[model samples]
Target: MAEETITLEVTRYRPREDREPRAQAFTVPYRKDWVVLDALNHIKDRVDGTLTYRWSCRMGVCGSCGMMVNGVPKLTCAAFLRDYLPGPIRVEPLAYFPVIRDLVVDIEDFMGKLRRVMPWIIRRTEQPLTAGEYRQTPAQLEAYKQFSMCINCMLCYAACPVYGLSPLFIGPAAIALGYRYNLDSRDEGYHLRQPILAEAVGVWQCTFVGECSAVCPKGVDPAAAIQRSKVAGAKDWFLSILLPRGGRS
Candidate 1:
């Protein structure tokens, strides 16, 4: 019997060689257990040594293998070939970002946004080493745990049309992470984070498209986080208007 095979339509872009991205097709033997990343790896090792992409910790933990698989943003490591079966699978670099090589999108934008959100525990004053460690209950841990699961897969960014249209938008992952740190019992950075998040291009830029949450591999609901932050910002504004001395005690 002839071996079953699958065709992959992968987007190829070389800065000096091509003006725009172009699709390159390759045929590989089909295996139920093989993923899209595996197919790309086969192409790299056996057929085309010049194909460039990024992948590490193929278990989907590193989140470096994210790509547009059949127009949906996904972790190529988790996208199985069996799901598409007997045909071509369209693979491309993530949308709304500059493709440096083949499937690799430049992540400097996301890195900058992450830093702007201050996604870390902040304290007005650090306690002395003699003090005991900060602790929390199960409920406290659960509050921010889901948002913390984000591995920076960037599938959310690819699925977000807002970010696609407006590159300056602070974006879902950054806001969701900012909310996560705000929810931390040990954090007091909400006031600090609010300035950036409450800016015109922050959470308000999101039209509640919810595609970010829909495509999140980790099940983190970034849309909800953004809406919640909006509510918090509004309440803060309302308080400032209604109370004396600017409402900030």
Candidate 2:
């Protein structure tokens, strides 16, 4: 009996050779346990040595293998070929980003946005060594735990049309992470982060598309975080007007 096979329609782009991305098809052995990443590995190892992409920790933890699979942003490491079987699977570099090569999009913009959000625990003052370590209870940990699961895969960005149109927007992952730090019990940086979050290009640009949450692999509801941040910012703005001198109520 002939071996079963699956077809993969992969986008190919070479800066030096090609003017733009083009689809190239390849057929590989069909395995129920194989993922889209596995098929890509087969292509790289056996078929095409020049193919370019990014992947590490093939377990979906690194979040480096994000791609457009069947027109949806997904981590190729977790996208089982069986789920897309019955024919060819369309794979391309993530949308709304510059493709450096086949299946690899430049992420410098996301890195800049992430840095701008300052997704870290910030303290207004440091206590002496005599002061014990800052500890968090289960409930406190639970407050920001879900948002902290973000691996910065940028799948949320690919799913977000607002980001696609306006690269200046701070974006979902960054806001979600900033909100995560704000919810941290040990963090005293909400005041410092408010300027960025309250900016016109920040959370207000979302337009409630909701696709960011729908495609999140780690269940990080960035849309909710953005909306909540907007509410908080608005309340802060109102309080400042009433109290004046940028006072907190």
Candidate 3:
């Protein structure tokens, strides 16, 4: 009896060496328990030392192992080899981003967008140290809990077609994060974040293709967040018309 093997057609590109990206296949032993990241580790450790990719926690919590598995954005750590059985699994860098090297895309754009969204609790006035903490009920926590599950994975950006067409779009994860903070009961930065979320490149840029929600591994529905933000933006705009000095809280 012979051991079964699987083929992985991985993308290879060296900026100084290769003119463009190309596929390089490698055959490895097929283990039902092995994930795509495991196979990649095997290649880097044994077969080819030059194969480069990013992976931190193999547990899929770090979101650093996101890549294109069979043309869909996925965390390689969660992608099982047995799922794509009996043959080659096409692996590439996440779509709609500039490839820095083989299976590594430049995420500076996403980082910048994330910063602009201000994904943190903000208060106009700070409470005194002796004032204790701003507490919330479990119901209040549940308001923005689902959107807070983002691991900063670029998977949503890769899955978004609007991002592919328009790079200036604020993107799914960033907007969802902004909405998350806005929904926080203790957060008083809605006025501060409104400009960014209501801008042309903000929630309006998302065409609601729904792929961002579809590919989310954390179950974060960024598509719903975008839609909800759009509604909130509209309500604020209408309130601004009615009340000259005040809009939304």
TM-score per model over all chains:
0.98, 0.97, 0.97
RMSD of each: 1.0, 1.1, 1.1
Cα lDDT, model 1, residue 57:
89
Best by lDDT: 3
Number of clashing pairs per prediction, in order: 0, 0, 0
Candidate no. 3 TM-score: 0.97
Candidate 1 residue-wise lDDT, 124-233, digit = tens: 99888789888899999999999999999899999999999999999999999999999999998888998789889999899999999999988999999999999988
Q: Provide the global lDDT of candidate 1 against the true structure.
A: 0.93
Please provide the root mean square deviation of candidate 1 (C-alpha atoms, Å).
1.0
RMSD, candidate 3, Å: 1.1
Model 1: worst 10 consecutive residues (lDDT sum): 240-249
Q: Which stretches of candidate 1 lie over 4 Å from their true place?
A: none
Candidate 2 residue pairs in backbone clash: none
lDDT of each: 0.93, 0.93, 0.94
